[model samples]
Target: MATFIIEGGHQLKGSIQPQGAKNEALQILCAVLLTPETVTIHNIPDIIDVNKLISLLEKLGVKIHKIGSGSYTFKADEVNMKYLESPEFKEDGKGLRGSIMIVGPLLARFGKGYIPKPGGDKIGRRRLDTHFEGFINLGAKFRYNREDHFYGVEADRLKGAYMLLDEASVTGTANIVMAAVLAEGTTTIYNAACEPYLQQLCKMLNRMGAKISGVGSNMLRIEGVDSLGGTDHKMLPDMIEIGSWIGLAAMTKSELTIKNVSWDDLGQIPDVFRKLGITIERKGEDIYIPAHKEGYEIQSYIDGSILTVADAPWPGFTPDLLSIVLVIATQARGAVLVHQKMFESRLFFVDKLIDMGAKIILCDPHRATVIGHDFKSSLKATTMTSPDIRAGVSLLIAALSAKGSSTIHNIEQIDRGYERIDERLRAIGAKITRVN
Candidate 1:
């Protein structure tokens, strides 16, 4: 395992570019299986999870070629369906959550798909009922094998129908959309996830000859098509990484410019941070966060109560950045309550912050109360373990703003989402070293 030894108390001041969206890359990469032609994708992030998915695809007989840096051309001309039943394939599929998406495209084109119990961050109970439910609504037969802990869906010919999702799940919507594109009739999805990731997926599918409407709303319409073709696509910048960088700048009192962030796609992210009294400026497509040497103050609600930041569906705050928000709040001037509604265990990382001399109350598994230090007392260095991808980056940010050096073990969690993170931070004057 690799560990990150971070020297704290340095301000990072340089421009950094956000990589392609990891969430979008997962959906787009799996969507490649929907067509037999060559699909070229640009701005793909070279991260662990994505590379694992690509390797899984290759195992299933997809022709992959590296065209350039962060670009690839995938040809699924002849997928080996027999590979899906192999133990090696099942093991590979169980390693990443994104592997669940391959089921949609495989079922759409080959009439069947199989997946082992998927694995990802242990932040909470991530159920697959939504994905399987959507498939069942689209005239597919769903089966689960308890002995092997596998899920399978098969359909002779899918016929589209209306579906009202219980919740707007991002991955579930992507999977269903991929399945519905090649169905026999029109499909209507209500209360679907309308995040930028889903919007980009719809646009990419449209370019590839799939008829889909409602690109930026919760209601989506899709007219089934005979087949899809090859297309070129460029992914948007990673919103989570941009938000993390914003938090890092605020906590460390630095001036950092994030280049070419899709300004329109970052819904409510900047505004949420601004509520914590961080100065964020939009210079063209870039975001500039100025130093907060005097420290920031948490803003209360209009009715004069304690401020609360909670996660909701798209157009609301994303759950992924709540960890960053909690970390940065440790240095603010006032107290704020962070409510993580989606995941129960994500807030458990606050215990590590409390050990670093911050005042935090872990109210429960879902909520935390942070009383800002206001720079009156600097955070003392400590050893910690990264629980998940978001929490890992959050701890790294905290360590950077601490009084002394800190060591974070299990940094592989951070690398799964952020590409060359230590190297990227080093470019911007962050004192982080990766040691094995």
Candidate 2:
């Protein structure tokens, strides 16, 4: 396993650019299977999860060409349909959770799709019921192989229908939208996930000849088209990475500029950090975070109650960045309550932070109360293992702000999301090294 040895207490400088959105890239890459024409995608992040999905598509006979550093052209002119049922595919498909998305486009265009039980972060139970149920609502037959832990959906022809999702799952909404775009009639999806990335997917599909409306709302209407054509699409900069950088700057007292962040799309992220008493300045499209030399403070509610930072659907704070927020709060001026509503196991990483001398109370599996050390006490470095991608990056941030050198094992989890993180941190005066 790869590890990161970080020299702590160093302040980072200069500017860092966020990579293409990993979540969006997964959906966009799967959409390429909807058309036989070349779909040129720009700003594709070179990360493990996204790359795994691309390789999975390539193995399924999608022709992929590298056009530039972060650009690729994909054409699914001759997809190997039988490959989906092969042993090699079952192994590959189970490696990443994003591989589940390919089933939608495949089932849409070819009338059938199959996937092994998808694997991803063990943060919590992420059920696939939303995806399969949506497909079933669209006139697809669903079957599961309990022995093999496999799922399959097939239909001779899909007929659109109205669906009110039990939950506004981002991937689930994306999958259903992809399937409905090629159905026989109009499809209406209420309670859809309206995150910016999902909106990007809808817009891209529109460019590819799929009729979709309500691009940025919870209700999505899609008028099915006979076929979709290929088009060029560019991915938005990863908002989660941008939030991480913000938290990193505050934790290490660094003056850093995060370049080319699409500010308009970063809903509630800046405000939530500001409530933690971090200074975030907008310089056109870039986010300039000044050094919190005196340490930041947490704000209380108007009624003078303790502040609570919780994750909800979009237009609210993202759950992915809660780990970062929790880590940064360790050195802030006051206390804050972080409630992770979506995932049960995400807060389990607080024990590692507590080992480093941070004042945190693991209230339960869903909540934690972080009392800021206020920089009067620096965290003592220690060796640890990464639990998941978000938690791994959070640990890396904690190590960077600690008093001595720290070692993090199983850094492959971090690499799955961030692109060349060590190299990028090194450029910004961070003393981070990747050890094999």
Candidate 3:
């Protein structure tokens, strides 16, 4: 297991670049299976989860070539369909939540798809019913094997139909869109996730000869086509990482510039931080956060209620950055409530912050109330373990602003999302070292 030993109280300055979106990369990488022709993807983040998914695709006989750093050309001319039924494939597929997306493109092209029980961070119950139900709505026969703990979907030919999703799931929308592109008729999806990730997927599919309308709304209409070709797609910068950097700059009193951020695509992220009284300067496509010598303060509602930051669907605050927001709130001038509606256990990591001398009230599994210390007392670093990818980075940010050296174990969780995070932080004058 890898760990990060961070020396706190150092002000980080200069500019840093965010990696390509990890969530979008998972969907785009899996979408490569939809076409037999070569598809080139640029700005691919060199992260563990993405590399694992790429390896899984290679094992399934997709021809992958590394054209350049952060770029790849993939051709699915010959897919090893038989490997889907193998014990080893099941074991490997079960280890990644993104692996479930492969089932969509596989079913669209080959009329069959199989996946073992998928695994990811133990944040909460991440159900696959959304993905499977979307497939079944598209005329695929779905089955769950209780004994082996696997899911399978097959059809002679898929005929598109209307679907109203119970929840606007991001990966679920991507999977269904991939499946519907090659179906026999038009498919209408209501209450779909319209995040930038999904919008990019629709654009990429359109470039590949799939007709999808409503790119930035909840309603998506996909006109089924005979087959899809190939196209090059570039991933947007990671919005979650950008938000994390904003929080890091505020907490550490650092003046930092985040370069090449897709500013227009990041809806409500900057404003949400600004509500916490952080100064955000938009210079062209870049975001500049000035050092806060007096520290940040949380803004209350219009009626003088304590401010509340909650996660909602796209166009609202992202749940992924709530952890970072919570960490930053610890040093702010006022109190705020963080409500994590999607996941049940994500806020559990606040206990570690409490250990670091922050005033936090874990109201429940879903909500936390943070009373700002206003930099009157600095966080005292201690040994801790990373629980998930987002929480790991949030904790790292906290450790960077703490009073002493902090050791964060299980940094492999951090590496799963962020690419060369220590290297990137070091470029901006952060004192972080990676250890085995």
Candidate 3 lDDT tens digits, 1-436: 9999999999999999999999999999999999999999999999999999999999999999999989999999999999999999989999899999999999999999999998889899999999999999999998889999989999988999999999999999999999999999999999999999999999999999999999999999999999999999999999999999999999999999999999999999999999998999999999999999999889999999999999999988999999999999999999999999999999999999999999999999999999999999999999999999999999999999998999999999999999999998999999999999
Inter-residue clash pairs, candidate 2 = none
> So what's the TM-score on candidate 1?
0.99
Better of 1 and 2 by lDDT: 2
With candidate 2 superimposed using the best TM-score fit, by how many Å does residue 223's alpha carbon deviate from the native? 0.4
TM-score of each: 0.99, 1.00, 0.99
| Ranking of models by lDDT | 2, 3, 1
Q: Residues 231-267, candidate 2, lDDT per residue (tens digit)?
A: 9999999999999999999999999999999999999
What is the per-residue lDDT of model 1 for residues 1-436, given as tens digits with 9 covering 90 to 100?
9999999999889999999999999999999999999999999999999999999999999999999999999999999999999999888899999999999999999999999999999998999999999999999999999998999999999999999999899999999999999999999999999999999999999999999998899999999999999999999999999999999999899999999999999999999999999999999999998888889999999998999999999999999999999999999999999999999999999889999999999999999999999988888899999999999999999999997889999999999999999999999999999999
